[model samples]
Target: MANTPLIQTQGLTRNYPGVVALDHVDMDVKAGEVHVLFGENGAGKSTLISLLAGANTPSEGSILVEGKPVSFNSVSDAQAAGIFTVFQEFSLIPTMTVAENMFLGREPGIGPFTNHAEMRRKARALIDQLGFDVPVTAPVAQLSRAQQQMVEIAKAFHGTPKVLILDEPTASLTDREVDHLFKTILKLREQGVAIIYISHRIHEFERIADRVTVLRDGAYVGTTAMDDTDEATLVEMMAGRAIKDIYPEIPHNPAEVLLEIDRLTSRGVRGATLAARRGEVLGMAGLVGSGKSRIFRAVMGLQPTRGGTVTWKGSDITNAPTRDVIGAGIYYLSPDRKSEGLDLAKSSWQNLNIDLMMGREARGAMIRPRALRTTAAGILETVELRESYRPKAVAQLSGGNQQKVLFAKSFGHDADLYIFDEPTVGVDMGTRAALYRLISDIAAAGKAVIVISSDLPEVLNLSHRVLVMAEGRVTAELTGDDRTEDNVLRNFFNETGETV
Candidate 1:
């Protein structure tokens, strides 16, 4: 008899009102293998996972576990069948302790009575086993994002799941934390656990994936052994077209400095001074907690500056409120799109119209709904965002599509300077190309742009000049011959004797 697959889906499909999220998709996961799912946002990766995890009922298809058909009407049903998923959006209760959050619904207890000490003991043991330093009794809200992610991982492993699904698990993790996660995943594979991994970071496939599956436009494109496929092939499969260049050329004729920061000091930034000019892209690079984001936050007036001077177009706006900063033709895009950037519950058109409607032009005016819809349609078209998704809640769109909406909102205003923090964090290659072109277009039009990213190649390729930050300070500023990854890393680590 042939070896039975751990989990299998036959002719699976899902459909929204006007969109086929998934279509006749067939997939299989084998025990002791890392099966990776690669696709552009909206290609149905999340939809398929939702069906398998019992979060959604498929329109048509069947799922089998170990060659036996099964139905999962709820998340608990999937868990009972030894399937667990750590979704991108965490499910932990922030106010609860780590131990309580881990064993949330099912606690160690006598009938109708909970055992707090036993829960803490088990949670602590799990954390230790995973090499994570998180207090079991501490509130989840007080922990950093990385620590909370560790808690999510620990929760997924609660019942020794037969099949584990991890979706963008390492997006917020540091390099060291990522290593720990990979080690744990390998151990799970050794224990014959079938793992379905989903991520947009292409660099991770070679490190962990055994077999690769590509999805495009809600259909299965193909599957290949990881070693047999190259990045170019994978990109083509995911995008359904060739993407020659991921980053556009940097602009050369930069105008006079439009924004200046002198001796800026904030909660997480210290004495950081930088200048951004029209027609220029100033890239900021640093590891997490190195204070890169703090600098941007201070500039956007989201954080108060202890001491500094912020001058824009010869006007001093130090420690100004966010509304005033935005009113003065400065736009800031936060990295956390779900909370800080876009309102998830609202439709795409509503979110896209926010900045425009807030402007002085729309003040005290009765903007027609038809006009708003027309304008939103035009903006979405310019960004290559699908018109079909324009009326849907932004939360229903894929990560890339939601990001496109955020981009549209930023451009909706007539801003002079644009600051984007990790704008392409969860976007795919195709959407990334579109975003790069948009940024380049903004610079070519003589508007200043600042790109703060953790992706080294992204900063190096897109920035006209690069700034390296370490411990709340700008260590090195590079342009021309001095701009390279090695130099950036050296400056990031505070290595001495490197030209700044």
Candidate 2:
């Protein structure tokens, strides 16, 4: 077969007022290959993908599809050209069935009649091809993160796309699910479909990608075959510097109990109870929909509790509103940072000051803009984001930097009990280490911290004690010193004799 590029970009440049997102970058993906885009948080990989996906138009440069230069005015235009994109934030509708979402825009119709049965049949075939066993008629919201990701992949395949783009698709998947996705990608590669895989997981590129492309500071570094590279070299290429071990050893010496939950029950959590002490970081590890997040959400008063008693500093705070909870010095940050934790379209100053203005601190209906800027600037400085950026859009920041912004918001509040849900998803090693250090500092400052994460290594390394949840129940409480990935996995599953 002749080597004709399926999609190629020559000098793709996208510029904002002060930020040149992608600067004269070149990228190419040939038929029957998996091309990985590797970069740090703010390295413009997402911007390049957005341009290719038609989410944004390039300020300069050109894109050629099958040797024909084209301008993709919208996503529909890209779809018409056989290019499909699956983003980290799923586009599946919760109320719709899997089959419905899979063939959303181009539903099969027989003589002006919508064929639901045929839709399910085709959806089932596509899902089976991907090695996933989800029911076609099931609502997407009820499915696990892995299942949702599988559906997203199925949707892309349903488009019969010649060029497929996946942005951080494995960020929320389990190890087993990741293996399944790898198998599906290999199958796609065999079928002559060009795949563009974007991720920060350096190890994944070695396993599945044929060629790796590195981008840094909005420019392309080089594209190298995976066999010719090592992870350390790739890390250096992405960050422009040598990165040593990022996770610091967590200190010991836990103090007295800080917050205690006698019995916590909610719609999502079924009669759960846990505790965290001062100067200690507690980790809640569980599978998707295992009720780990519910416990934290219930404590934060975001969700309604059926029956429970939450004792903070020896006072009952069951079902208390968030205002009182924040007033009592307890705060929670959601895993979905863009939607729940940040107002992305707003300026950084606005997002950082929203929580402060809500509290009794900023009393009037109208906020003091100068004072808000001062406070937000202080938070940004403390989190090490102000030096590099201030007054920029929070959404425009990279995943790691956005996470840092969320952390800064929490720190600015100076909450007594800090609950973070999946704090480091889609973040690079260097930034993850920085976040871990900051979390440790929060605990070291005599505040209780709860980290809810599926990444076992993070939970094991950052916490003073680890709590495992399964089937909406607290299965075991293990000391963090003795915790490992294998140990946590063993405890999470049944048929393993463990203590709680």
Candidate 3:
């Protein structure tokens, strides 16, 4: 390996009001090496990427490209300098075709019209190069989340960037899709392109990264060769302290059954049966599109069940209206916070207070703004959101912060049965801990909590009893001593009759 750097940053700093996003951080990326920056959410990873992508200018710092210091005025400047970034959010246009999104503003054009044939050919070639099997002519909106992510990658590659920065690239990808991405990344490295990979799953880094860089609280911690560091060490460095156990054990007395779903069937899905006792934390785990989310939507009245019975506290509530479901102290928090869980245009206070503003909670049909503000503040504090962010738009806060606001909204109302679909999807360790504590507290308060996630570790750690679902049916149930990761994976593949 050579000592020459492809990209370098010195004394980088950025501040946002009360928060110091980045503080005098220095980083180096070498040609042909996959360098991973390890940090939790809000650990300056996104801010640093924004700076690299030229989406934001640094308040203080110097960035050097190809061993020469250069100031980037905009994203175009960064692209011209051989830098491309894939952020956590998908950037593809929903209404456009995959080929169209791939080229976008750089589509091939003749003297007066777009050369659609040429554009599609290039798009198909790029997809082939990346080993992605999606059709280039398909509408982007019709593709799954993982396929949309592939289009984002294809877009970055179309720019022919020498240095690629992927932020949480596999957050929404399935296991097979992740393997495909790894293959593409390795090909990029072979071509002498410097790749900066950032992710929460530290274990996956060892598969591709040459060296690992750790950052904590906007400051540089240390960098170590992948061979020299274990997952525990990397986690400790990223967190700035020892977290002996990722999940804190919270004890609760099991009571009578609080929720029962008998033969909960939707079209093309089977009898999805599940139950949760009062004060119980039930975990549902499965692969993507395994009918996990559909079951959740059915319970929340967001989808119509073909045939089933849902009983809450011994009362038949299947196929009930959403408002009636909420009235019965059963509410749901979705995985996609930006879309379903929040109103992006509304203020944080309004998002927090809207539920209360409905019906008589508004004090005889007139919403009490003062009371709403008070209540919002209290809930914001409950989820540990900054007080200053209360008046800002829900879109202004970071992903993890937005999620906190969602949690605050859920807790604002006294819901007995809480269905959290991918509750900690994009959250980091610190925020995730806070979330687990909040869930435990809610359940300890005698409410039933059902957590559905694709992450095995989360299900094993947080669930009192783990139920593995596959093909829209319950495959295996584990409790007490049988909920280990290895055990869960074994059950997942064994019962599903498939290989990982």
Each model's TM-score, in the order given? 0.91, 0.81, 0.92
Query: Residue-wise lDDT of candidate 1 within 22-110, one digit each (tens)?
Result: 99999999998899999987788999999999999999999999999999999899999999999887899999999999999989997
How far residue 283's Cα lies from its native spot in candidate 1, in Å, is 1.0
**lDDT tens readout by residue for model 3, 197-296:** 9887766887899999888888899989998888778878877556655677867677999888887897534787878888889998888767777887
lDDT of each: 0.88, 0.83, 0.83
For model 2, which pairs clash? 329-416
Look at candidate 3 and give me any clashing residue pairs.
none
Q: Model 3: runs farther than 4 Å from truth?
A: 15-19, 93-95, 110-113, 131-135, 138-146, 358-371, 495-500
Better candidate number, 2 or 3, judged by TM-score? 3
Lowest summed lDDT across 10 adjacent residues in model 2 is found at 491-500
TM-score ranking, best first: 3, 1, 2
lDDT of 2 by residue, 34-147 (tens): 999988777888889888998899999999999899899898899899999998777889999999998887899999988999999999988887777689999998997768
Model 1, position 330, has a per-residue lDDT of: 90
